[model samples]
Target: MKLQSTLVFSNELPPVKKLGEEILLIYDQILAQKSPSFGKWAKGISLKYPVKAGEHLKDIEQFPRHIKAITKLTEQTSVKKLTVVVVGGGSVGDFGGFVASILKRGVRLINIPSTWLAAIDSAHGGKTALNVGGAKNQIGTFYPADQIIMVRTVLMAQPEARAFEGFGELIKISLIEGGKLWSSLAKEKQINSKTLWKYLEAAVHAKYKVVAKDPHEKKGIRHVLNLGHTIGHVLESHYELPHGIAINYGLNFALRFSVQKKVMKPAEASRLFGEPVMGFLLSPLRDDLISVKSSDLAEYRRLLLSDKKKTKAATLRFVFVKKPGKTVIQEVTVDDLLIELCRQREEELHG
Candidate 1:
């Protein structure tokens, strides 16, 4: 076959190649599955394909100008067979996937996630989005990637903090899926594509399995995936912290809230989140949104009310831990949430 963009799975897959091992083995195992014309992963499933890597750069504030740049690149590159663009995850995946979802009505997408966050979380279930104004993921789509590409080698260049951020997703994945995968990564001396693939695979599998059941996140089952994200996304917007780190921060606050609400027991929360959780909280939330104000609680509540996932009655659905590997979405009033948010912020300041 010449080439075509399609998702693939191998039942008789070859043994994984080592991190610094053969280049061809690395390519065949992961990169070969992408777009071949561009030497991209999703389009490159067959052999005899040439590869070229492109630079994708964006800051949190560059969405409009960035989209225009991508549009011009599409026109400049004008290859008729180009059906999609594969975005490596992290902020780039969110931005690129959002652009691809809108361009020419829509284009094919294969997410080749390089960062820990993208591999375990952002890569597969193609809900592409961009931030509008100051809100996080304010705009997005339900488009799923035609294929999901993951390789541990791509994550090798990431720094320790970035690795830690990805670990937060691994933690969330463990919460929803199970603890076996997380325990394995915790034992590793250092994380890399080779050793980290197991965690990524577990996360991707959990996401794909949920998406298979509820493709649009309309059903309650999919909401379980958002366990720590309700507070995580908010903190990310308000604090300007890295997404993964911000999630770790959010997970702390959410679990605390869940405990206060009596939705889950304190000991169980400690087991999932390591003990002395309070000590591990991300400090100095400096962004305008996260900066503590007289109305921080009110602002947080307002944003929660704006979420598209809210019911027609304007009630908010929050994902809370029922126990490890289980979560439940509870609809609570804006006033009630604000009171709880204030109480938590007060405790954080006092202790």
Candidate 2:
């Protein structure tokens, strides 16, 4: 499956005049306060929906009202000519993409990701998602966008701290693709917007290569993309950490687990950990974030079971790193995962 979206890199947001005459701009409401120029530009759109960006926006219960409002908003326009332009981070992209996929049995969708995380990962995958009963991505579709516009100005405009959140996904794809992407990235000492921009295109193309093999995820080739996401999602929901930050910790967990299981050689694991770029993966808040108490075990079990990748009643497909560019998937029971979680946490405290 070839990547269908046209990928374009630009210094600034595409001019509104070029977005076509009939466009419905669905953007994050926060952009108005965060980026004045973007606010001004969005004001030019005749039909626009400004949304609060986060997990709440993707709630399935609320989707009915949202879809109803959007349907009424664009009732006058011809669906053939109408284009839904989604502008924001992952959550907004998920919500907007889902809308475009179902709105009038599908419409032209263009993604203008506003955050580094969105620009680097979520915005490209064409996976639109929503939550059900507090579970993440329980309902979603593989709706690829017609165009994905990556604006340097928009991504750079984010707060410097936001770069760390994006770094997790950047490192993830680099590890999954390895070779030149990992070799060059491993040498970098600093991680900032410039670092992210330098390798944005490479990281995106690497993800496309994975997605192309398993466009709809039927063959499980794309499961590798969830390399760090298994436990990442658990932490994200448990502590409400940003998706990228949680994934960083999850990647660390997976690497450690790989060594414990004898999947990755200890020498290679140590070498990977010793790299300058790998230093950024060590979050100072690691203890506070992952120090799972016995009482928390029940909740963690619940979250793990709720995971979409579950292969059995109590088991899920876990992605383990054998080395850069190669991953191994194995099914492990929930108890096995919780035990590892405890072991890793104890090691962090004492080892």
Best by lDDT: 2
In candidate 1, clashing pairs total 11
Worst 10 residues of 2 by lDDT: 282-291
Give the distance in Å from residue 192's predicted Cα in candidate 1 to where it truly belongs. Answer: 8.3
lDDT of 2: 0.88
Candidate 1's C-alpha runs over 4 A off are 1-80, 98-108, 130-140, 182-198, 270-293, 306-314, 345-351
Q: What Cα-based lDDT does every candidate model obtain? A: 0.56, 0.88
TM-score of 2: 0.93
TM for candidate 1 is 0.66
